[model samples]
Target: MSSSSKIRVIVVDDSALVRSLLAEIINRQPDMQCIGTANDPLVAREMIREMNPDVITLDVEMPRMDGIDFLGRLMRLRPMPVVMISTLTERGAEVTMRALELGAVDFVAKPRVGLASGLNELAAQIVDKIRVAAVAQVRRAPAASAGAIVHPHAGGAAAAAPVAASPLLGRLSTEKLVAIGASTGGTEAIREVLVHLPADAPAIVITQHMPPGFTTSFAARLNSLCQITVKEAVQGERILPGHAYIAPGGRQFALAKSGANYVAVVDDGPPVNRHKPSVEVLFKSVAAHVGRNAVGIMLTGMGADGAAAMREMKDAGSYNYVQDEASCIVFGMPREAIAHGAADEVLPLAQIAPALVARLRGAGDRVHHRI
Candidate 1:
């Protein structure tokens, strides 16, 4: 491809080695090129104004300006796709979550082990995310006060308590299960859905594509904001109403029935569709075990990983929903599910949770897909 046709990129990091490694990896891709490198957000700001690259790989920590703070500024002043490069520490994961809410496209966890070897091992992932970010729909965020730290659902459960307390869902809550799958923009999308569900809502099981060491923080982050209890799925635990179980990163999570109650099955299995905690695995189990008592949700993501399996869910008598194009960061997964004749309703990101809750309460119309 010609240089002009390539996806222009900027690398922003404090570490010289990381910057060099990322530049090399990006330049090696035929469809992308590293146009510049910045050691901090200040330099990056100048490069961005001059070059206006298609995407930027940003480090989560840096001098002169904190990465999250910079990202909030950039999104408000000049919105564009950004993929964060972060250390896989508990703190890093928390910051990464904040970055995503600030409108970053995605993130790559810098492995805790060998620096050079670890980055080399993630070459495919690094490039793949850049490709996704290139065409992703980006929006400017509302500007925040200087020195103010913005967090998703800043009010926590204390602020979320009265928002979704449904007294109408009684026996229906215990009888049904909600199966959800997402990737790419899933972090914010999943949060949008879970926060709208009441504490008495049906059991929700989710699979969001992520590497190990991230989901624990992800689940905890959600738990603080949503009315329903949220946690990483535990093996053989009875699935309870009003709780959401997130598939552990790097592991498979599926639904099963033990005697009179539903339980979670988590284990190390071969990667399905190149993802361990694949949506396909979780949706399929919901099809086999929950059957007509299940509701399937396919959110914003970048592949067809769960499309076919979600069709199995529809065939098995589950009502399903997929996020519509306008709200998706990458429409690949939802488009595929629509092509496969799955989704019963195609709703926007903000509408999905309310719609799902209505369906469970037997109050919504199903106006809905082929992959």
Candidate 2:
């Protein structure tokens, strides 16, 4: 964060042009410097030994050794933050998710075409991701294996039980909605929260900053791991209990009440706070439509995208929770919500899912009381 301590970065890609352009963008930052570039894993392995960079930008696919394999080895051997540069395709998104599971800090999608022109459009994003990566905590691979990585927020098996009785679980409980917003490190954060939820939890909605072609895979990934169904939001679909809808990337998703039931409304809109599926947009919609019947959650991210709207939700009588700084990969979103007096409670990641269950079960009024 200081001027003297620059964020040392390394760019690893097979393309000469990409390496050069990435180096240029990284060097342009006042607080960052690209110390080295490598065309393949072999070269990167040797360069890493000498440079010892604070962060790495890796291409998703490479000759000889793919990015996923190399990332696994790197995290196992010498844990450090890594940001993946992946193609904008379904395959790329799936691979990027694997990289995250292998300890990647984040990822940026490569332009579909026009390499030079697209890279120019992504200059700010590339630099910002690098800065965030530099500050991220890179955990070493688990002792069991590199593939055994689990999110820090995931709770044990007991978290899967449904609350027997509660104020929100009566005949009127279907009207309740749980709205969640996250970015940066949110994919895993959301997964951690979702996997612990019971199959009968209230309807949940999520907005995680991501590019086109990624949200479907993300939703599928969660659906496979969680007890509840998870799917990408479709316009006009009725919101139902035990299901989680993820906002499609590159579009705005909002909640709209149709008489007694709520439905997802998806539309093309200009980016809000520089994100298409901005957390602010979703939170604002929930505050307006669901009011006190909603529960707002602000999770790990790199920006204050949802802080003001979260406050609006709180002012409308809805209780809200934020992930605490110590458990977050980056504490920007939750920290901002806390600063704005938007959060009712700041909880560790491992406690948030269970706390939500307790609140909906009517026990939260006595336990995990609002600060």
Model 1 agreement with the true structure over 1-371: per-residue lDDT tens digits? 99999999999999999999999999999999999999999999999999999999999999999999899898878889999998889999899988998889999998878999999999999999999999988877765555333323222111122344756356667778899999998898898888778888889999999989889999998999788899999999999998999999999999888886999999999999999889999998999998888899998899998999999999999999999998888999999999999989999776777777777666222211000
lDDT of each: 0.88, 0.86
Clashes of each: 10, 0
Which candidate gets the maximum TM-score versus the true structure? 1
Residue 116, model 2: lDDT of 84
Clashing residue pairs, backbone N/CA/C < 3 A, model 2:
none
TM-score per candidate, chains pooled:
0.93, 0.91
Q: lDDT score of model 2?
A: 0.86
User: Model 1: clashing residue pairs?
Assistant: 336-371, 337-371, 338-370, 338-371, 339-370, 339-371, 340-370, 340-371, 341-370, 344-368
Give candidate 2 misplaced runs (Cα > 4 Å): 1-4, 143-149, 152-170, 363-371
lDDT over C-alpha atoms for residue 294 of model 2? 91
